[model samples]
Target: MEKPLAYRMRPRNLEEVVGQQHLVGPGKIINRMVAAKMLSSMILYGPPGTGKTSIASAIAGSTKYAFRMLNAATDTKKDLQIVAEEAKMSGTVILLLDEVHRLDKTKQDFLLPHLESGRIIMIGATTENPYITINPAIRSRTQIFEVKPLTEADILTAVDHALADKERGLGDYPVHMEENARLHLSRATNGDLRSALNGLELAVRSTPPEEDGTIHLTLEVIEECIQRKALTHDKDGDAHYDVISAFQKSIRGSDVDGALHYLGRLVEAGDLAIICRRLMVIGYEDIGLANPAAAARTVNAVLAAERLGLPEARIPLADCVVDLCLSPKSNSAYMALDAAIADIRAKGSGDVPDHLRDSHYKGAKDLGRGLEYQYPHNFDNAWVDQQYLPDKFKDAQYYQPKATGKYEVALGQQKNRIEQWRKESRQKPR
Candidate 1:
């Protein structure tokens, strides 16, 4: 059985690796390492199908080192031992460890010695943020490099190369892909070269040849194979960002029809994940306290859409979009939070008020923590205002309630009542 086109077409050397110029380009880190022949263990983190494995293999091929691949989560410590043994026999081996963030302590301990001895040059690949997911022990031992998504041009270049390569690609097949079909293949795969190549191969093999025995690949055939329709927005293009911006602004402006139009465009593009994410953000960042229930409902809708994946997911997503568009909008909550954050950033976060400091600890009383605190629950309304904010920000007011909905209107009224009470109390206070 023959391997897939994507596997066969993997870049055997750095020159053949598409995209990621920041790393593979002239004077870059990887290029510098390869040029000096002083390879270090490094982690490549990024989204799927973005040349992580290819870069690892290319490095090994360029250096003429033995290359081994393993999964950090699935492969055991025994596998690491085998690779370590191979490195001992061969002097050095480049090991591409996929999902490196999932490396258990046991396996990590075993691999550390080998990595330090320059026996196994580990190239860890993961879609996760290694800083948050990987242990410091492993992170300290290796340099980290971020792999970026391929652009449409890069995908086009890769696809064109695959079509022209006689030994590894579909060059033997008389494939005559339409220009539009080729462009759609580049734009629709969302910067995934593996997906683009797979879609291209599937279109070529599944498509019937013409009367003259030429395999004619059309846009429709490519679309069917890739399971995505070519939309006005190229997934990586400016128009895609425009559609998303329009989608959010329409909802924020309470333009139901406009929001729905943009939503349909996104749905047609088959970007359910983006739709769900944007809707949830709009729910809180736009609707907010003005229509808190609507925001809650939007969250429910997002959960439903995620649970019921696509086509069916679009139903709940549409329902949520309509609900959010019709709901009263307010940015007051986030704006106020932003104001507070700006204050903290500009004039550092002052210490917590002494009264508000923790009082349950053994030495808290001696330290005067909570000594002057007035427990609000003991007061009438359970809302006696003492000093909560640090003395430096005694006059700082971050929250400005907007009366855009019944709920916010009530909150505004309560705020006015509290301010009046505070004013009266201040007039009589020492």
Candidate 2:
């Protein structure tokens, strides 16, 4: 059987690689490595279809080295031994190890000797953050580079290249793709060249040619062929965390549109667990004392979402996200608690004040515990000056209230009155 269009259109050399100018462009690391023919074991990591495999193939082609492909997760030690034997005969062989993050100890031990001997130039490809997922031994042995998502223009360039190449692409066919349809094909795949090229082939093969003997590709045709836009969210990959970070930051920054965009992505990925967890955090961490009611409502919204489930769950999530984006923001309460925690961690918490300590036990008065304790409720405004903090931290102030909302403003005013009373009490004669 003939190879698929995507496989057939793999870059023959570094020059044929479309995107990743940062790595493959002139004077860049990979380009310099190729130019010098000084191949080294390396790892390329990023989202799917962003040209990790293409880079490996291009490197092998440019160097004229024998290229071999195997999956770290599936291919056995025997397959690695075969590649090692090829390296022994050919002087050097480039091995493309897919899913290198899943490499087990046995296969790793077999490959390490070849990698160290410079007989096998290993190019590991993964959709994971290699630093986090790959074993430290393997990671230490290779150079790590991140392949970024291709731009729309980059996707269009590759698509055009595929369409114009007769031997490997669709240049043999009398196919006429409209400009909008071409743009849609590039955009719809969301930077996946494999999807775009294969989708193009599917559209061409499935559609009937006009009486004039030309396949006319339209927007609808390409849209139907591609089916759905590829979302760059692998729960086990870096993109998942990146989206969650953006979602929380957008809401905290009060950008309704930006927050909604990220929320929509999470919704599309069906990550209700993360959504609920993050929203509840943002409600307290970002909205806090400024709008406690909004934060409470956010919790209720999350509960509703959990009960309703996705598709329909997105409705309440959207409502909460919008409310959070527009609500008055304050982190004063948590910040105050964090400050006290830092002090306790650094200087250590001193003993509780004797006056504040429990004194209901036998012979407690002899220990002076609660001996001078005064009940604030017996005084005016249900308030009185008393030592509440440990004597060592008597002057420490952790609660710095913000005036972002009416409720916090009232609390701030009350705090000022208490501070004034404490100052007066401290100055008075004992």
Candidate 3:
């Protein structure tokens, strides 16, 4: 049987490849590597259908190197051995390891020697972050490059090429696809060019040609084949950042309903990691010092979500989102740091006060370092007034606790007490 439209439509050469201008455009890194046939072992990472496998194929095609493909999720150790043997005999082999994140130790052990020997030029492809998923030993051996999702224009270009390629595509059929249908295929796939082409193929091949020999592909036919509509925010696309921004702002604004709504959208898209990270950011940047308990709870929930994974993950995630939204918010710490940083940039870092310098080392007392440092533990209520900042910043205060949350309210009261202590100490003798 003929290969699927996606497989047949794979870019056979560099010029045919679409998207990832950062890597394969003229004078780009990958282009230079391919032109010189100096391809090294590397890991290609990113969302699916952005052309990891296609690029691997193109490299070998251009270099005329012995090429082999293996799916790490299914292929056995023996499969790797076969490729390794071929590579040893051929002097070099381009081994495309798909789902490389799933590569087991047994297979990795077999491939490592070949990689070190420079016999197997491995190209690892993964949808997940390789640094987090791949074993460090294997990762260190391969350079990692991310293949970003194809844009709408890139997908449209690929579709147009497929519709015109007679030998391998749908050129034999006289078809006219509607603008909406074309747009749907391009955008709905969420940058998966292979998916767009496959959907386009199914819509074209299934629809009967009209009496005039034009197989007009309407939006209805395209929708029927594709089944799912494009989401407003893609998990790995530009809209993903927007959704995260909105989710964080909603929590910061104490808008529980808005926060939950955006949280649900992200959960449905199956990106627990992104949600977990956003929760942590919200805890510190948005909820800092206002509710220490909330920040702690958010951290615990993130741990639980990661341990449980998926369906159960959403439970902890929901708890976190709700807590974060309902809790009193503050950007005091965030602003405090920014204020301190601005000072540091405007004025040079002043020298540490002599009293604050280390006095534990031998002969340090000769220089009078830490000579008059006041031990706070010896004072009343374990609080004492002393110059902790550098000489020029003796009166500088970077932290200003907000009274928005109960925790910060207590902190504000403590701040008042400390100021009173400082006043009393100034009038007293050393």
In order of appearance, the predictions have TM-scores of 0.69, 0.63, 0.64
Order of the predicted models by lDDT, top scorer first = 1, 2, 3
Against the unseen true structure, what C-alpha lDDT does each candidate score? 0.90, 0.89, 0.86
Which ten residues in a row are the worst by lDDT in model 1? 231-240
Q: Please list the residue runs of candidate 3 whose C-alpha ends up more than 4 Å from where it truly belongs after superposition.
A: 104-106, 208-213, 216-220, 230-430
Which of the numbered candidates is closest to the native, going by highest lDDT?
1
Q: What are the RMSDs of all candidates, in order?
A: 6.5, 12.9, 6.9
For model 3, residues 255-351, the per-residue Cα lDDT tens digits are 9899999988877656676788789989998888889899999999999999998879999998888898888888898898898888888887899
Query: Which portions of model 1 show Cα errors greater than 4 Å?
Result: 232-249, 276-308, 327-430
Error of 2 at 250 (Å): 12
Ten-residue region with minimum lDDT total, candidate 3 = 228-237
Cα lDDT tens digits for candidate 2, 308-400: 997799999999999999999999999999999998998889999888889999999999999999999999878888878877788899999
Candidate 1 Cα deviation (angstroms), residue 332: 10
Q: What is the lDDT for 403 in model 1?
A: 80
lDDT of 1 by residue, 169-270 (tens): 999999888777788788778789999999988888888899999999877798899998765624334565678899999999989899999999989888
